[model samples]
Target: MQLITWNTQWCRGLDGVVSAQRIVDGARAMADFDVLCLQEIAQGFDNMPGAPGDQPAELAALLPGFQVFFGAAVDEFDAQGKRQRFGNLIATRLPVARLQHHPLPWPSDPSVFSMPRMCTVVTVRDPVLGPVRIMTTHLEYYSQTQRLAQVHALRELNAEACAQAAAPPKAETEPSPFQPKLHTPHAIVCGDFNLTVSRPEALVSAPEYQAIHRAHAHGRLQDAWPLAHGDTPHAPTFRLFDRTYGPDPVTADFVFVSDSLAPRVQRVEVDLQSRASDHQPVLIAL
Candidate 1:
């Protein structure tokens, strides 16, 4: 399976371009990405300039064959008295089995007022891979404190969801010995984590990686990047070669996996060349 994660910056390209067609075209050119995780998708949010009336719908229209799920981190009334959304989105070509919305903790910064961050979970049945879970999220970018808390919340949420699914169904009826039992499904955590694995406090296996590690330890989620590229020069997923930003930047987009699904991790690539969005899309294959 091929998966891509990008922060679309409300589908507004660098300089004054705001075209969903261009974004979709760029994504299609990369590869037939089975799942696409998009962050910063604006939908009638406060009547901002270049804001689409309905971004998710527009993207769905652009990719006719795909099923889409949008999780609104913030929903407020627009000037026209209609509800508007600002949040994360996932588009997939496979049959959707489940969809969930998980809200992340908001920051306390007084000056950095913005919409809340959230994670959208999409479960689909891949033709060759059976059942798979795709979780896409954009975390708090400003405050490290808030981001750390959000990470912990995410780990606990995932564990709870997975555990509930694994539990046997409650029923008074007798079970059939010939019936097949399903195992706990695998999950793909892809998004702009904002917290990099290079940071000791963000790693799942490290002592100071924070409570998120503890939560995932029970859930069995593992970092897929280090597993695939282990200390390689995959730095700089952002600020693409523009001399104005800085000499070097850091990577914030990530693709993580459940410990049970690590064996199926085929490859992970940080596509630094794509200018579909301000942030580069991280592609992962299984």
Candidate 2:
């Protein structure tokens, strides 16, 4: 199975043009993927950069034969009284058995600007892997306090899933909303994590990276980059060579999987040439 994760910056390109069709075209040019995870999609907000757009509807209309699921972290009524939403999306060609939306920690941090964050989780039936849980999210970029809290929340959520998989709930009667759904320990968490290690002097440092590795060592989760390219530095997924957004490039996006699925990681790559968004697309093949 091939999966792609990208932060579409609301489908705006370096040339200051916002086109949802171009975003789809660029992703398809990168790889023939079974699953597509996107972040920073806007809806019914005319004030955003280029123009007002319903990105979710536009993308769904553009991609035929794909199940589109959107989880909005920011949902409110605009001045025109239309529903405005901004968040992550997961579109897949595979069969989805279950779906859940998790709102991440958004405690008030007046020290810096921030926004509400969320994760979109989907349980899909892969042709080879059977039941697989895939989640995508974008963390708070401006506030480290909020970002760390959100990270802890993600870890807790994973632990909860693992616990549930080990001891599932009893089956309920048919036609009930409380019916037990498929839950798996195997999962893939991918998106613009807003994590950076380049400037240990200012922002995050080695401890953050160590925490993630420790989780992997305990047989909970593992980073896909090392599994594909051992000991190599991660490729830049944000900023990179795009000066339109700034010259200081850093790696913020990632694809992480459960340790059990590490061996199935065939390839992981970043599309360096695409300019459909400020961030580059990361693809992983299993």
lDDT, model 2: 0.85
Predictions in order: lDDT: 0.75, 0.85
- Candidate 2 lDDT tens digits, 1-286: 8999999999999888999999899889878889999999999887889984899999999889999999999999967788889999999999999999999999889988798999999899998988888989999888878887887777777778877887889978796987987878888989998876555233225544445555531237778988998867788888775755455777889898987788999999999888888899999999
Q: Name model 1 segments beyond 4 Å from true.
A: 107-111, 169-183, 196-217, 241-247
In model 1, which range of ten residues has the least summed lDDT? 200-209
**Best candidate, TM-score-wise?**
2
Residue 112 of model 2 has an lDDT of 89
**Poorest 10 consecutive residues of model 2 by lDDT?**
200-209
Estimated TM-score per prediction? 0.85, 0.93
**lDDT per residue (tens digit) for residues 137-191 in model 1:** 8887666677777777778777876776678455445566534434345788878
Q: In candidate 2, how many Å is residue 194 off?
A: 0.9
